[model samples]
Target chain A: MTKPDVLITGSYPEWDMQPMQEAFTVHELAADASATSLPRDVADKITALAMKGHAPIDGAYMDALPNLKMIANFGVGYDAIDVEAADARGIAVTNTPDVLSDDVADLAVAMLIAQARDMMGAEAWVRSGNWGTQGAYPLKQKVSGSRIGIIGLGRIGHEIASRLAAFKCEIGYSSRSRKETPGWQYFDDHVALADWADHVVIALAGGPGTAGLVSKQVIEAIGPRGILVNISRGSTVDEPALLDALESGRLGGAGLDVFENEPKIDPRFLKLKNAVLQPHQASATAETRQDMGALQRENLLSFYAKKPLQTPVNKTGKSYPR
Target chain B: MTKPDVLITGSYPEWDMQPMQEAFTVHELAADASATSLPRDVADKITALAMKGHAPIDGAYMDALPNLKMIANFGVGYDAIDVEAADARGIAVTNTPDVLSDDVADLAVAMLIAQARDMMGAEAWVRSGNWGTQGAYPLKQKVSGSRIGIIGLGRIGHEIASRLAAFKCEIGYSSRSRKETPGWQYFDDHVALADWADHVVIALAGGPGTAGLVSKQVIEAIGPRGILVNISRGSTVDEPALLDALESGRLGGAGLDVFENEPKIDPRFLKLKNAVLQPHQASATAETRQDMGALQRENLLSFYAKKPLQTPVNKTGKSYPR
Candidate 1:
């Protein structure tokens, strides 16, 4: 039997491919290639595609890949890929989810603490030699016992909530539907949750459905002395409106791992000292990245061997069924 | 009768002095004067000296102030004030201890987490635009659920232990004498404690007595996977030896709030990415600092009234004598 041809379109640490090479006939895509950048000839023959976070495998690219059997995403959040387009082509979609929950949650909390206490600003103050002549400046904001609101109750969101419980924060959440969980108070409305929470965290799914879900009204409800953290999709928030809230101090601070434009973040955000900006690195820890790569390879091998895929994207509902 | 003269040696925030001024004849010393830098002429007439952290009140200064009845310290450690000499002269000394415990403990945990995860380095990577091209690097060390060794289990140490308990960390400690605390394993020796702990924190008091408590042997025992956090006093750890450990990567990372020759940290420390350096600001939050200033002023007034000081240094025993 001919080995399944897998086109891997993400840069991984060199050691990551050792396992991939052992399992399949792997084709290395150009380091900078988006899903659209694949050559026409290669797209026609590719049996599987492995994608990274930056690449967008939209409808146009899905239509071009005639032989693609599966798109094994290297991380959680398949927003970059049009799962509906793949579904129309009868191609399976898989994501590495549970493996990254702890790591992403770690970064989320790290960013929250870093932003809340102005850790970065404090470090800079000391390094700038102003600390010696001046005593420490007034404290920033407090983190312990603050009211925290989570927007989405998925695997990663639940992990963040569990970790935050140790800090004595009151945890409140808003999901599409509520399920009973100890220590978590569910809110039926996101805007109402913002009004009551001191820190509003965006951890919802990334798709057209969730796009702009956290609107200007929700941000205004967060009011002053409130913080916003986004570890989920950037599109879930209205970036320009959020910026206005920050400028006016309607929101206290933000720890954003995802941005509307991501690698090309709003330049205005650079001017805001209260914002802790990251390059969409919620699951970027070494252990988690390696695990994500390994999981992707496992998904591919399982599909080839006629075994069940571990984490399919379209588990309960049809992807964009119309 | 004329009100007793109170000399404020350390600068208190304007708001901190309102209550004290309403009750005493206050002489404001220059806010920026270091203990050693106070003019001899000004020192001659001081009836009571109000000092803050690390403001040296040595024998020479005390001898100059013939009318000095008390030295009221603003924060916990009075290493700069010679307590033994003050006691010999019947000059009372007091500090604000328990009030700053929670705030200082909060900072200790923040520094520990920041150092273990290389937060400073990660933030710099993102801000410098290197993260997009380089991707996220391996975190320096682990903090959660790790074996944590604490030296000096006093109020602040106990506070840190309570906070760490919530994180599920295994707690081990070495103090002057073994004390019974639930869930805490006491080690008779520092080296033995270091050998077993993934992170070693120095929360011991500062003075001639603890100048070099954490020596090379103890640091070596901590090994390559170990982290060291010092929020107590810079004199507790041998700075030269710590620099060597970090240079060789024998110790994973360090989060320091105090230094042996503070405001003059070893330049070698600046070169290391694993070190999270803060300018001795453990109790530097606004609320804590204000509380400390107010407490110091209150202690001075109490001395004027021939009343007992609130938080006197324990020169003779395990606990402060009333």
Candidate 2:
């Protein structure tokens, strides 16, 4: 049997790419490819889109590939891919979840501790010969037993909360509904959670519903003694307010993995000593990325075999032609 | 009822100093003060010593202070102070313990994840505009579920192990005797522990018995895929071997907070990209430092009132004059 045509819309590691090439007739697009970037001849042959990165896959992009049956996203978040649009057109969207949750949670906890303990600055003190000439590094805050607020009690958030619980932290969370987690305080209001926590972590899913979920008031509530960590999406926060809070000392500090217009993030963030900035590599680990690739490939293979989609996100009934 | 004469042999925070000044006839000495450095007249009146930092308190120094009755150390590790000489001279030695365990353990775990994730390098990538110009940061190792070996399952090591359990890491430890810890595997030998673990953390007390405990053979056993973290004392590991391993990639990487001849640490360490260096700051947090200071002061206050030392290290019975 001939390999099915697969359109790859983002950069993937060679480990994923090499196997993908062997299994399918793969067509490549730049990670930053727009709807117009796809060649008309190639788009017609593409039946499946293997997606990665945060490049938008909207209705127009979907319309470009007429025979498109499925879109398998590399990471858990599919906000960049307009899922509602796909569902309306009776197309299926599948994301590689669970596999990347551990890596993301690890980075979230890492950033929280890194910001609290000033790991970056402490390392700088060691490297600059300041530790010898200037004596001990300036004392920073402690992490263990601090009151921590998790903004979303989803898969990743639950992992983060569980890990921090071992640190003897008081875990408080704000979710759509109260979870069954024992010993965790549930807050319906984000501002209240921020007000009570020494450190606040955002693990909310990104999309229109959560855009600006962490507002100016939330930032203010996480006051000067409170640290804010975002490992979710840049769109989940009001960047202008966050930058203002960080700059004015209204917020203690931030350990940010995602940012608004990231890569081209607000230049102001670069200037703040209180911000620990990461370039959206939260789930970017060798072990986890490989797993994510495997899962994405598995979903694509499942669709091809007419087996139930491995991890379906939307109900696109009878959309895939048998 | 005059206040007893007390000599302070190191730099202490103002919070500790102000109280010491108010309670006793406080005498100041440089943190690097030696036996010969002490003025004969000032030493003659000193009945107790309040210590901080890693300054040596030898028998010769004790001989200089003829009336010295007690030495209150401001940190958990009293390796710098000659405890044997203090024992022979019947000087009550007290060290601040338990107070700084959380902070030290927090840093130990922080360094482990930081090294694994290349957090320092990641931040630099963001700051250098490489995140914008160069694309996603390179994938790094995963921390969660990794095998970890704790060199000493004492107060601080137990804290580290407990915290790591939340990350779902497999915990193994090497201590003088098997502890009451249920899920943790115990190894009697250091090399075996290193061989078994993806990360080896040295949490042993910094004294003669434990000096060079993480030897060259152990470093080699950790091998090219394992990380070594030292939050204990500089003397606990053979620094030359550690340096050689890191330089040669005989070991995967290291997260070191202490080093031989630190401050003046080996220049080779600064050149390596694989290692994460901290300036002996495992217990250097504002909250913990304040607690340590308070505990040290409490011990000193107990000695002045003819009470038992709060955290005595040696048996110097009936030596302190009532």
Candidate 3:
């Protein structure tokens, strides 16, 4: 078999590349590699593009590599890759989905409980000699048996809801319409769900139409006693509004794994005692990432073999698979 | 009818005191109020002693209050009370149990996930501007689906096991004997259970026999990469051994709610990044505490009415009801 040359962009675990190396002549490129720096000879032969969410994979970049047949995203979200542009060029788009859901869901619940119990502050209380000096860490809220509302009842959201259900939490969700899944109460409007919930978790897919979908109104609707947890994109929330609400005690607290600018999160968030901040690492468990990397490799191999793609995001007409 | 003078020898929730004041002529005293400080004539009138765990209710102290009829403990684990002395004196000992189990279990699970996810470090990474500067936070171990071993499958341990079961965690337990609860693996030997589990949680009762139960041997058996969570009494585990193991990487991490000398804990545990230290606050949630306070009040009210105590720890020879 003539190994299809794959142009790998963005940073991944060094260990995860062993199988990629075995199956293809992989070209390691800086995520922001300029057109001139792109190896001209390798570009002509590159059939598959492997990249992370932070890496740029736009139409112009795809056009540069005319032989590109598919773009295999390392993580579930394909927001980094312009799906419409890839579709226009007849390039198949694939994301490692169900493989990473459990880790993401676990993280969502972990962060939620961390906030509910004030684990960060509680730890600080012990570390700073406060427990010994002052007294017990002040009482926080209980997480189990509370009402939880999940926005976007997708794979990751369902995983979160399922796990929370085990905690004896009342599960509700918001989507375009009611999902086929029974036992969960569905709200048409996101704001309505927030109003009815003790905690609102943002789990919707990130992209153009979804930007600021959990607006300031939804934040207020959830009220001061309610916590907002985001394991999804920061763009889905009105970041400034959230900051204002959190700072002013208009909202109770937050357990955020994602941020608006990311990495360069707001400086105000650093000082807030009520917030439990995390880097966008919901699925960054060693085990899950290893599995996701394997799945990404499988998607590439399946595309090359002309078989059905394991997890397709878009219908690139001729090469599309369920 | 003249009210029975009650000496509340310990701090309690301010909100809870309102009802206590209404029900009886409450004489508030410091948790460590000496035998002499108790008003002279009131001692004879005092029918019941409402105290917390820190307030000593030994035979010598109980002798000071000759007319004392019962000891109503504010929390579970009446280790401070000389149960044998109380039984010998024919004075009932009542503890607030079962009501606080859910909160304690919730905290155990919360701290477990916090340790598994490195939530403390993850939050710091975001807060200190390291997420943008240093890239993604490093991958951590997964909590869900991991093997969990619980010591003392009592009310709180049972709650912890039930919550973990929702996360698909494989459950094992160690106690004097196997419990009625099926589906959970049982180990009579504590060290054997620790050796088999990825995580070990302490939920045993605190006392002399149970002291150092989770000893150095059991900690070594858990080995590295295994997280230890203690929601039980600090006396239940050997603290010095735990500190040594955590410091030397003999154990991967810990989520501790108790210490050998609480509120005066050993300072060595402050700097360990892998640890998620809490202030012995397993049942410290506001909602749970409120419920616990209400239950304590009920026990006192029931005692005064010549009715059976609500949550009795030992028989009093007189009024004893469910």
Candidate 4:
């Protein structure tokens, strides 16, 4: 039997690509590749799209692949993919979630402690012979028993709160609705949570509706002694407001894993010693990434076999006409 | 009555010093200052010593302060002060403990996750615009749900284990005796624990008895895939063997907060990319340090009042001649 043709719409690890090449007729596109980048014949043949990164997949892009029945997103956050558009055209959308939650939560906690304790500064003190020349590294604030306000109580947010509880942090969260957590305080307003938090971690989903969820008012509420950690999408936060707060010491510090225009993040972030910047790598662990790839492939295989999708985000009422 | 004369044997934070100066006749000495550093008249008048850092306080050194009755150490570890010599001379010795355990544990967990995740490398990628110029930071190993071995299960070690447990790590420990922990595996031997652990943390107290406890064999047992985190004294591990392993990739990585000759640590440690070096700052936080200072002072104040010392490490049967 002829293998089904699939178009990879972003840069992926070689581990994911190698096995995928063996099971399917694979076509590649750059992470920023447009519909025009593909030949007319190849675009017509692609029955599925394996997507990664933050490149937007709109209705127009989906229309190019006429037979495309499914989009298997590599990571948990599928905000970049317009689920409404995919549903309108009967394209089943499946995201690799739960698998990457542990890794993301681990990073959220790591960044919180790293920034709180100034791990990089302390490392530099030892490496630069400053411990010998200068005295001890300047004392920083303690992380244990501090008030932690989680901006969203989703899977990733819950995981972060669970880990921090062992550190004796008082956990509070602001979500659309209350979650069944063990005595974690819930807030209806983002600004209220930020005001109460010694540290605030952003774990909300991204998209137009949630854009600027952490607004200027929220940033101001997370006062000078407060640390903001964002492991979620850059769209969840107001980057300019965050930058201004960090620069002026209006916000204590930030441990950001994502930013607007990431990779090419605002140069202002580079100057602030208070921010712990990272290349959107919360789920960027070899073990977890491999698992993610396997899950992504599983969804693709299910799509071709006419079996039910494993973890679909949107179930279209109508079947694909393929 | 005239204020009791007390000599501060090491440089301390102003928060600690300010209070000490107000209550007592404060005499200053550098961290590395010796008996000869203090004027003979001042040494003769000194009744108490407030100590910090790892400066040796031997029997001969103690004899110089003819009126010295007690020594109050700033940190949890009292190995630097000769307790045996103090006992012989009937000089009361006290150290601040329990108060700094949370901060030390926080750093231990921070360093463990930092090294495992290569947090410094990731931050550098963002800061140097490598994330934009190159691509994603290289994938690291997953820290959550890994097998962790705690070498000592004392107050600080227990705290570290407790925090890591929330990260979903399988906790194993090697202590002289088994602790009543909730289902944490216990190994009687250090080598066995190292062999079993994905990561091993050394939290044993530093002294002659426990010196070089994490031997060359233990380092070898931890193997190439294992990471070592030492928040305990540097004297516990074989530094030469550790360096060799780190350089050769026989050991995966290390997160060191203490070293044999810190400040002037072996130049080789500075060269290893796999090792996360810190300037012995496990308990160096503003809130914790303030508490430590208060505890140390409480012991000193009790000593001058002819009351029982608050946190004495050595019980000198005889009262000081002073």
- Candidate 4 chain A least-lDDT 10 residues: A313-322
Q: What is the lDDT of residue A262 in candidate 2?
A: 80
Chain A TM-score relative to the true structure, per candidate: 0.93, 0.97, 0.96, 0.97
Docking class of 1: acceptable
lDDT of 1 at B140: 42
Q: Of models 2 and 3, which has the larger lDDT?
A: 2
Q: What is the lDDT of residue A101 in candidate 1?
A: 79
User: Lowest summed-lDDT stretch of 10 residues in model 1 chain B?
Assistant: B313-322
Q: lDDT by residue for model 2 over A1-322, one digit each (tens)? A: 8999999977887999999999999998887777567778888888899998887899999998998889999999988988889988778899988998888988888888888888888888888888878888888999889999999999999999998998889999999999999789999999999999989999999999999999999999999988999999999999999999999999999999999888888888889899888889888889999999999998899888888787888877234434
Residues forming the 10-long window of minimal summed lDDT in candidate 3 chain A: A313-322
Which regions of candidate 1 fall more than 4 Å away from where they truly are? A30-47, A88-90, A179-184, A316-322, B1-4, B30-48, B59-70, B89-91, B131-145, B161-169, B177-185, B297-310, B315-322
Candidate 3: deviation at residue A122, Å? 1.6
Instruction: Specify the highest-lDDT model's number.
Output: 4
- In the order shown, the candidates' Cα RMSDs to the true structure are 4.0, 1.7, 1.8, 2.0
Query: Candidate 4 on A1-322: residue-level lDDT in tens?
Result: 8999999977777898899999999998987878767899999999899998888999999999999889999999998898999998888898998999999999899899889888888888889888978868888889999999999899999999999999999999999999999999999999999989899999998888789999989998989988999999999998899999999999999999998988788899999899888899899989999999999999889888887777788865124223
lDDT of 2 by residue, B273-307 (tens): 99889999888888999999898888888888887
- TM-score of model 4 relative to the true fold? 0.97
- lDDT per residue as tens, model 1, B1-322: 7766677765566787777777667777654454345566655656787775465777766776777767777888888888888877667888888878766777788788777667776666667767656665553444556788999999899888877765568999999998778769999999999998989888899988988899988998898877898999888888889999999998878888787666766667767877788877677666667777777877766666666667777352112223
What is the Å distance of residue A312 in model 2 from its true position?
Answer: 1.3
| Model 3 lDDT per residue over A1-322, tens place | 7787998887777777877888999888887684346868878888888887565577888889989889899999888788999988889989988878878888888888888888888888888898888887888898889999999999999989988887788999999878877599989998899999999998989887799999999999989998999998988999999999999999999999988777788888889988889898888889898988998888888887788888888878235542
